[model samples]
Target: MEMNSSNLWVFIETNEKGQAHNVGLELLNPGHSLSRAQGDEVVAIVIGQHTEAAVASAEAYGSDRIIIVEGEEYARYSTDAFAYAFHALITKYAPTSILIGATDLGRDLAPRLACRLKTGLTADCTELDFDEESGNIAWTRPAFGGNLMARILCPNHRPQIGTVRPAVFKKPEQDTSHKAEIVREEIHFSIENIRTKLIEEILDADNETIDLEGAEIIVSGGRGVGGPDGFKVIQQLADALGGTVGASRVAVDSGWISSAHQVGQTGKTVRPRIYIACGISGAIQHLAAMSSSDTIIAINTDPEAPIFKIADYGIVGDLFKVIPEFIALIDEQILTMAV
Candidate 1:
């Protein structure tokens, strides 16, 4: 396969419903910058059954070119099928760089594809930029248990591969006025070659559906919450405000909540419209994850808590009392609006 140094491919991972993941579109925001830096074109690769939705989204979001492969075997994600399809595409059109979302399925498929292509892959990249000197993609991620940051460069690799974290970058605004070149490749994977089988899909119980990344408002608690019982108040406030629950590393470590609710450099990074921190002292790692929120409200007993420094509105008091007052005010406002 001949390497094409003029193309940067963004892998758009789609679900069984053919809906493209947000991270794929989010990468396009950075992809355009990378392409501009090296004078390259951004190409979106979509592989799935009934890929009309994904293709339309890629086209709407802005891609210089779109390569699509549709087949029944791709309806549900299997490592073998996806890897085989991606391998075939990469072999046919060797791109300079490949960006994939660091999702559960993506984490499984990227290494396999990278190994087949015999290239280096950087995972959980928080930052990506084009290096002018080496002409390599600079992939940045937290290293050493989130204590430090590492910048990786695959200068020797033909097509640099990386898995970017979700919500690290915002999705670009839709530009229906722009159109991209669409290329549909007919590549079928034999049933025998696909070693994996999809078992019965079991949905997550009610507790596991915390969507902090897509949340408009997040109410978080930390060590000041005391214990699991303290989270009840936090949940009450979040429920009253119709928001999701978030926690610092300490709260997760203490078993007050699930790790899925944890927010920090080591956990998930979030940027919501409004973030309410209750009893949170705000460590640097925690702040780094959510400091980009549009509005931050911090409530703590200590006036000098670090969280107050960045909070848009700071309340130095006990969260237990403050939160109830907030719920009352919201309820009153809703009632007034109804009247």
Candidate 2:
């Protein structure tokens, strides 16, 4: 199938209740910016049942056009069904670029879509930019355990595809006053065409884990922190800074922190404004996750810790002593401001 359209397309992921996920909005920030730079429009494609609210949210997030495909079969994401529907839409609209969130579902679905479209896809990208000279996208991601950054480009593909880590890009501010044309499309695929069978969907009770990717500030701990008790100080520091707590792979493997807080090559990739590392040695895997932070502060007793190489500010001291003092100062500052 040949596509004749030339717009930027974004895939919108919605919950069971058809509420748009924040990651979709996050992708829209770059999508809209890229569209404007390319002199094209931002088109969002959402697939699910009762997607009116999702379509509305996409428009609020800066989509110039919303394509809603409604069907009960799409209520739960099935790779085969989703790929078929999205493939059809791509053929019809002919977009210049396609962007998806690097979430669990997106990680599973995007590669399948790329295979279906016979195009290359750059996954877990930390940065995205338009090459004005070539009119192509420059997708950058960690190559060798976060030691090197690789920029990828798909020259021959009509619709270049890229999947970005969640929370790497700032979510576009909502423009409720800005409206776009909503096109309700039909999902013509039948149940027989779907390959996967739906089993029981069990919702976890403890889903309140902090999402580090979306966190503006993250304070992470590493082996230098010693034991699980050290996380108490780290958590207090995060609380004082009004940020979330993160951990290195060693901390997570040692059961010092939940896997949810782990940030590294095998864990989540974060691009917060401020990433404070306490007792972290700055392993390449750990750096791969947060080297893109706007400001990086490292605190380790060892002056030669690998983390100091990339840290904008390196503090050589015991985290137990340093973290408490920093928290106290922050508290005092807050009180001073109130006074």
For TM-score, the strongest prediction is: 2
**What residue pairs are clashing in model 1?**
none
Scored by lDDT, model 1 comes in at 0.90
lDDT for each residue of candidate 1 in 1-339, tens digit (9 for 90 to 100): 333457999999887679998899999999999988998889999999899999899999999899999898888888988899999998888888999998888899999999998999999888898788888999998776556889999988778999988888999999988899988899999866789776687664644488898899999999999999999999999999889999999999998888889898777788899999999999988987888889999999999999999999989999989989989999999999999
Worst 10 residues of 1 by lDDT: 199-208
User: Evaluated with lDDT, which candidate comes out highest?
Assistant: 1
lDDT of 2 by residue, 66-96 (tens): 8889898887888888888999888878789
Per-model clash counts, in order, read: 0, 1
lDDT of 2: 0.87
